[model samples]
Target: MNREPKAKSQEPQTSGRSDTGRSERAKRAEGLPFASERLTFLEHLTVERGLSRHTVEAYGRDLEYFAEHCHERGLALPPQIDEDCVVAFGPYLASKRGLQPVSIARALAAARTFLKFLAGEGVLPADPSALVSRPKLWRRLPDVLSQEDAATLCEAPEAEAQAGGRLSWRDRAILELFYASGLRVSELCDLKLADLDFQMGIVRVTGKGSKTRVVPVGRDALETLRRYVALLRPKFAGPKDEDRLFLSRTGRPLDRIAVWALVKRHGRVAGIPGDYSPHTLRHSFATHLLEGGANLRAVQEMLGHANISTTELYTHVDAKRLLAVHAQFHPRG
Candidate 1:
């Protein structure tokens, strides 16, 4: 990854520090119960996932609220969390905090995602989030490209690559890898040249919370990547480029924004509808894999999802398949 430029030294803060938005949150959450764990998760969101400042602060505040609730109840959390800890959260939100239904639901959702991450890290024995009843809102499935649409998008850059277009090789490789590996945009951008193992047909990805996973690269994407490395990458390599597998025209490592723009431009060229982004390719990758009868656990690991519950999201939306199974297996049927 391209190193962020160091900030110039600034004046030291006064004895009486002015605690603003994030500072105030930290000051409050700092002394609260479970502050250590909460701070670690917030750091994970900021550093690993590269979430925006406001977004990380939002999560920090929401988690602070949860911590306060637990503290008030004298609930023993961490090293173990059970249904009781999760079960009481909704009532505490509604009655004690007097949060509206929507606000309460949002908190629960955030907490659920957070807890799942902890569980995946083995910090918690199990995720207790599922014990609480979720607000029965419509589940929005991810925007997924059909296989034909995905093929069109992945193939869209070939003409440009063939015509000696600038960075077309890089673009082709990125698109193919996006479809093949089901990587989060952040994970994809974090990849290094050392991560790829063509002999093994795998790439090592460092994902959220600094967790690493190995995902198989399809033959097409792997071959394209080899060509990009041999033919194009050297041309773009700068002294500071280091081991980054992907580089910008300036020889700096590619960031998430570049990947998004690349996917959007290619989506338009492919004439696919609904403003697909890099995430669309990721969603499609998981969707296609599961639809191809890929095991749930395998997909969970490949996508670098902290929790299998997330991987299960792609499966749950297949209503027709669920119904077919019911009809086939039920004794009454």
Candidate 2:
């Protein structure tokens, strides 16, 4: 087990005034009814619902931004706010505040949730936020490697395998499983030794919201995993008999950040450009399946999307590729 030491910081400290100012604003904003209600909701999400701090903060920020927008519009406090007020706030955010479509949509979603909470608590007569429509924008397709590029990336572990003379099989297995199963980085890191069923060719994954699903492993991925388990993993296992499928050099479970760095390193080796990460492989997995004529429902199931709408992003990717092909070969000038 070889644990890398934390790298020392080299950059000089910037001004702290901006940080102090934001803190002050956050404190003052917490006093408002909107903010107070948000704090309560956040507390519920954390303590009762057991959501991660990252998710709580994201929801907090979204609600806080909407509350600030309402304040700017001179709308009466939470009790006085109505659907029309929220509807107007959308244009206000877009036209006057110059928020992007994604930002507006997030804010709207937050507001809807908060308003529903208020309605449930009998604080408001109705859920006004529900009336606010999310802004519609052309879906921005995810970046994915072509099949050749994906193959190149999967092969990148060979170099590391040869140089390190250890964990090469493990690295190859990780890369292969990622592209083959379309597992989210978190899901991949969470994998356990017991999750793989070699005979059945299935890997059980616990996805977002802690939902469990079984994904079939391709032949290449299964072979890679077999070799890794037989040749490399034993060398890295510690006395604890930890079940984690992927491990750090130090014989601990690999964390998400480490997985992200590994993906970037392999992308560089594969000549992939412009901020590629582990999710890029997941995106590639989905897009490549659609391009290969897989049905949307099947892709949705494999990707573990709770909603068909969530899976529809690949449709946009598929359309763009079709447009490219038509332009390249069509006779129309």
TM-score of each: 0.62, 0.76
lDDT, candidate 1, at 249: 61
lDDT of 1 at 33: 74
Which residue pairs in candidate 2 collide? 2-249
Task: Assess candidate 1 and give its lDDT.
Answer: 0.79
Q: Which whole-number lDDT from 0 to 100 does residue 168 have in model 2? A: 57
For candidate 1, the TM-score is 0.62
Question: How much lDDT does each candidate structure score?
Answer: 0.79, 0.79
Clashes of each: 0, 1
Model 1: residues >4 Å from true position, as ranges?
A: 1-136, 320-333
TM-score of 2: 0.76
User: Per-residue lDDT of 1-333 in model 1, one digit per residue for the tens?
Assistant: 222121101112222343465477677878777777887888888888887555676687778778887777776567545678777788888988898877777888778878888888888887888667777755567888889999999998876666556667888899999999988887887789999999999999987656688899999999999999999899889876568899876577777766787788777877888868888889889988888888989989889877888888899655545687889999975
Residue 301 error, candidate 1, Å: 1.9
